[model samples]
Target: MRSWKRRGPTYCKDTWGCPRSQRKRVVFNKFGQPIGKIGKKFTNFLGTVARLGAELPIDQFDWRQVPNEKKEDAWEVVQDYYDVDEMHKSWTLSNIGTKWKDWKCYLRKTYFDPGFPCTDDRVIGDQWTGLYAHWQSSLAQKHSITNKANRSKQVMMHTNGTQSFACKRYDLEKGSGKVLSRPELFKLTHTKKNGKIVDKA
Candidate 1:
């Protein structure tokens, strides 16, 4: 665990208008790449960073819309705990933004879309206190809803359990004594140990 101290909780100067504290202490898990519960925790931390560190609104649609400088500031906030080196700064920034986007989608689909009250501190946490209006407006937009419905209709999903494609690729490459191309990697990952292919097409 690592505790990162920040100036305070802040938000859009004219819109969300959250007060800035003198100092706020945040604890982060000194874990490997954000995945599973660790990823969710990191996502929430990114949300806090958007509201406080970047002085951005909670409803920002595109992560890329956030200024690179502000994103860098957020990256600085997390790099130490995540063990990301300065050399990988670009990837870290992109990862942080992507994680935040994934997190909002999760919150919208699981909690907000289901009519769950956002005020439940135990369930949603204090970090999302001011997200109701934002969720109702920008996040719940028509195109986004359509996209969510389309994604839910996905028929064939990965059967690789919790292991990521990158990890599986690494294992396959190590065992085969040759680097596998995308097609080969896809074929291997989709085929079961019993020789049953996951995708018929």
Candidate 2:
């Protein structure tokens, strides 16, 4: 819920020849990391491509033949050539909900915390154990409390919708008593681990 005031007229001075004044920009923040700005014109162009049901025309780009300096210019020309008004007509931004916040917070905590097990090994222990341990360690460090019951309660809430046997241990420890889908658990763990790798790599 932040707003940005335009500092000056937007203009494209680069080789693409897009009118700079017509550009619109949106900025996004995921957790604390800034995703940066995306121009309305670029988004519109992508929408146009989608509406036209056309694959972006990159067939002419032969990587081996194109010189480094000229390759950028070639891409711009290709992008501009495919830009059409029809794509702009279908473009709209919609809210996708905030279900990702807990996961994002967990990842940020895991990445920044020194106690996280994966700091030494790229392959963390079994996904559930690693994530739960990270969460438990983070809470313990942050709150300075050693009560196992309190830690288990936090883990249950944090690991909701996760179905690993480790998650069951967490649930039983917390005394909430519920089960979740194994496939869903696997998907969540894999996706988060992959994201961590991508971020570090």
Candidate 3:
């Protein structure tokens, strides 16, 4: 034996009912009226077809053509977004505020020939030796020390391929002389015309 279920209403074939699952007792909004269902099914169908079409390997597609005047306006919009300060920071130089006359005098009196040295060949008594003695005396006066053994000294030398010279000094404890390094001596002898230090001969 089989039981038969009773059907309340047959509304599937009705054109004014639910479009997909056509029901007679259709749901409604606050206003008592039939709510149409055609728009939902149309939108769903179009979305599914678009998803399937995207899987195809289409190389080119048509885009709305932009005019030349509009393209230039778009370029200006891109340039306006750039940061001004970050772009110019690396181009700036450090300013030490040293006077030009003082630097020139220091170079002439401390390193040049005929300034302190009697002649170029006299090694024991040269411009550098006098500069070192003056530096030692300055240090002694600053520290108020009477003994020469209480001073500290430093020296840097600069050199080229063939010729070299002593160019820098401080003051040494218990020593009556100056010293120089290869790089500093090179700068005093072979500098650029613009007063920039040169690394190579």
Candidate 4:
């Protein structure tokens, strides 16, 4: 049998008992929910699909590995994260308030949400080193860029009881070449301006 699921945009709270994530979604990594591509058939004559018995938890993803050649071509966006001190705290499930968990969830939104790959480059330094450590460092870098830009912006409320947040981007004609330097980055959000469009570049 097919498991129950919400098909539409998840942030909806309709009167028909649909669930909503309120402001948005908070990623869950504590548990794994088994999911399968196929369900049952109309009759035993057609053979029924079996339910998947296992699933890897959200945190099982390996960060140090990525498709080498493919990573350069898929080039997308510079995933961003928030650098808060709490992210360094203990993330064991026993800690009802886990900073590490919070940080991981937020970072994931930037990666997969922006169509970026899940793999990350391993950091080489005296700080911390390991699967989790690499992510912590990279996410910190992303967080700084986004946080700085956010702090520099101003939001205004309109007199008509409306509010909007818009920032102008200059240098729409700037051009830059591509390199595969590990630190430089292959994926980054598009900054195209002046109504220009790029089909494939």
Best by TM-score: 1
Candidate 2 vs. truth: CA RMSD? 22.7
lDDT of 3 by residue, 125-153 (tens): 44335534544466635643543244343
TM-score (all chains, Cα) for each model: 0.59, 0.18, 0.13, 0.16
What tens digits encode model 4's per-residue C-alpha lDDT throughout 138-182?
Answer: 775687579669867744312211110110001111134332332
Q: 1-201, model 2: which lDDT tens digit per residue?
A: 889874432223342355544434433222211122233334333323221101221111222332444433333433453332322221221110121222223344566455544442322335435444545666545653554457575522222232333433334434644544565444444444234321221
Model 1 lDDT, residue 201, Cα? 75
The candidate maximizing lDDT is 1
Sorted by lDDT, highest first, which candidate order results? 1, 2, 3, 4
Candidate 1 local lDDT, 97-138, one digit each (tens): 765676566567667867876542223344464555665676
TM-score of 1: 0.59
Model 1, runs deviating above 4 Å: 1-57, 67-69, 82-87, 119-130
Model 4 CA deviation exceeding 4 Å by range: 1-68, 71-131, 135-149, 156-201
Give the alpha-carbon lDDT of every model: 0.56, 0.34, 0.29, 0.25
Q: Report how far off residue 134 is in candidate 4 (Å).
A: 3.3
Worst 10 residues of 4 by lDDT: 44-53
Alpha-carbon runs more than 4 Å astray in model 2: 1-18, 26-61, 75-201
Q: How far is 58's C-alpha from truth in model 1 (Å)?
A: 4.0
Clashing pairs in 4: 76-188, 77-187, 77-188, 77-189, 78-188, 78-189
Off by over 4 Å in 3: 1-35, 54-58, 63-201
